[model samples]
Target chain A: MKKTTLFDIISPVMIGPSSSHTAGAVRLGLLAKHIYKNTPKKVKFTLYNSYAHTGKGHGTEKGLLAGVLGLDVDDRRIKDIFNSDIAKNIDYTFSYADNFKKHPNTVDMVFDDSMFVSGESVGAGEVAIRKINDFNVKLTGRYNNLILVYKDKPGMISQVTNLLQKEGINIAFLNCDRNAKGQEASMIIEIDGKMNTSIEDEILKIPDVYFVTYVEKLEN
Target chain B: MDTFEQLYKECLTKNKTIYQAAQENMAIEADISVDKVRSFALKSLFEMKEAIRSGLISKELSMSGMCGQDCYKVQQYYKKQNSMFGKLFEKIIEYALATSEENIRMGRIVACPTAGSCGIVPAALIAISEEYNCSEFEQINALITAGEIGRIISLKVALAGAVAGCQAECGVASAMAAAAVCQLRNGRVSQILNASALALKNVLGLTCDPVAGLVEVPCVKRNPFLAVHAITAAELALCDVESKIPLDEVVDAMGQTGALMSPMLKESSQAGLAVTKTGLKVQKQVFD
Candidate 1:
């Protein structure tokens, strides 16, 4: 069993109606925003199953938008956020559907024209980033995370991790998902501490590394 | 990651209490000073109190308008009634409703195990602490004790309606609150464990049937009901009452029962009260 912290039991002092719907929505949105790495000019949210069915009641849609706008999970302004000036800067639309295959409280985020990120509000204000664009990967945003979209080639993994080892940043977890043999692959590494800009530049310097993103740990 | 039994035995051998063992173990696991743990627990207590303080004055409903203002209604009823449960009883009900209502309106709250069951622990701890005049330090210890109880149960079952329904959420919270109240009265380790087991064992099969898939309706009302329920368990435990099954075994039973539950009865809202004619109508009215 995973160690359940007193913080996990008693904290996260969050804005609520539902933790999974509201707080988890904010978290997923924050992670997607981190992956996108910019203030989105336009966005579409595809809420699935229970999120579609009961999201409005729980203010999940509001929570998601507030999160994308860079609001914290405990921000009181999220309740009336749609009317806020910050919301006026973005173009956002919501659609609902039931995909029996997806988790009940799942959302697919479409950012700009090309960035598509899908995530799930698993429960109890815990979220997991399930996919980025068409690439399937796993990220929980619990730790400082490094994400890489690169060619599937030998030594690529070692080269990326070797940079971290040189920087003395301990790797907490690492995951790799590839689209095809010797083709495009996504690698997500959760590290214990920060990987500075120099480390990023070093990783990007590797051959066949298409893109790199560093996502900071979510704020408590 | 010692089991509760292992922790208890260690406490007895070391001549330390269960809460002390919990605090020491947490201090090690989190790599923080024990005082830091105490301070962190106090932070949660303050958050819980803030929720109650704000919740008491607000009359906001949920976004769906299916629930809310019931806390206000309870406050009004308490003001006029003179007979039954009296002030402390009135405080428990009113505070529970208040905190839960605040949660629905998206106010900041300490989710004791969860947002849906946030009200129960605060209701019990605050009421008893205030009436008995316990210090904030004592209150933190009680809350930490409660947190450890909740933590142990959650190890067996994920404390969410989607996973194990309200039994794991609200039921476990009631158990947590029971342990807290036991600590407030200076109950022994055995008594505290028994109180938690009694509270949990009674609500073993309780379903997480939030109507219209919202945490309001039964969830908000259930907070006060279970907040009061913790009292029965704690009172019995203080008298040296024992649960036939141990606390760990009771938690294990809860996990087993959750595994055996119908998918619809969980937070999916596909069955139970969520499927009632009124529930379906509420869903349509709010969503459609």
Candidate 2:
């Protein structure tokens, strides 16, 4: 009954075979690409449980690799993934893990031997990346310019807000996830914002801020 | 009965009755009895050929017909030629004929549910169609029987993309094809529904992940396997066997299972296929 269902049925173009195994994989990958610090060089993908077993057949391998390469799901090159020259540009390998504790389609990616991104393909173009490298965060990437980090001492939120205000950006939603007051915690800020190259530099410069990343919302 | 339960029951009973009536109408030849379901399938096939040969359906139309029965619902797909159902219907029959010809030539066939999933259904459907020269009426009867099975799944397991992903799409398509095969083989409607239930139950949470967000890559080939699976399940059911639970129960279970399924597994491509590294790469390449 959801509107997305009708859109999917009505969409003129859909990649072959299955929707979840292909389209959703690309969306998740695109999110990760935006979040990563740089274009990844060497990537290691650890597929947990069912993903490790049946993923290859479903073209998850191509889907994941294409995502790291920052390709959209509609690209025709996806079919040539196994033999693409672009795929050669990135060093990628896949392995399986026995972690059922994670979602069935969980993929833990180690990007360029630096950033460790862990996420699950929830289904139908939806994903939740629980961790990006060491920074712990949960986001669906449904909108543009999402920022998450560990909340620090007092005035940090105010300072962050002032910095965004200086950049002529407005905050749409700022959600903080904390265990206890004054303790180390996480915050997710969804904003009507865009990272203009300097945004990352500005946020990373903040003390107590572990890391900074950007996410662009995918169109339905 | 609960809503899902009642729907499943209705599907099973109706499917059974239609199949029985169809089978009872099949005329025999050469010391062998033809199946009503096969007869119906063959008739559909012949009609497709006639439409194509008479220019009511063209090569393009026939090719589109390979997409199966669902194509009729959205006639605007061929807006270049004008949005017309009459033309679309002709094309639909042409595609069905072409698809059938391709399957027969390919030899190892897969029948998509009815001729709709003919690419997959016939992988199983033609095997029986060829085995027995079933008439067009019998094929329609078998399709109606299969439709009941499909309806049961739609009510219980979900035909909507938001629910069970591509699993319900092609998976249910395969299940329906298998049930029709059972009917053609003279299996009781209960048996036919059982085969359908078994097929759906076996592949419950399959995801719909079209690589590159296009319905090209795995979608075309996947139908054939679904057709093959339908045949396998039907054969299993016809061997004096039935699901320990009735078809309706399986439908109910499939619906609940789809409900509990994650949104990622649905057709959004945001999850299984859309979220992968390769998925992103393909997407970027496309948009860039």
Clashes of each: 0, 115
Write model 2 residue lDDT over B1-288, tens digit each, in one string.
Answer: 223245445547666364443333322211224453354445444432332232222222211123333323332355456435344233333333334333222111222322123344434554465457766566666665565455445544546455666666777777767777897787865677678877877877777665444443345456545665777788899986777877667666667777788876664466776668977676555434
Could you give the TM-score of chain B for each candidate, in order? 0.98, 0.62
Clashing pairs in 1: none
Deviation in Å, model 2, residue B201 alpha carbon? 20
Cα lDDT tens digits, model 1, A110-205, are 999789999999888888999998788888878889999999988999998888988899998899999999999999999986778677778889
lDDT of each: 0.90, 0.57
Off by over 4 Å in 1: none
Candidate 2 has an lDDT of: 0.57
How close to the true structure is residue B251 of candidate 2, measured as C-alpha lDDT? 65
Question: Which consecutive 10 residues in model 1 chain B have the weakest lDDT in total?
Answer: B1-10
* TM-score for each predicted model, relative to the true structure: 0.97, 0.48
TM-score of chain A of 2: 0.81
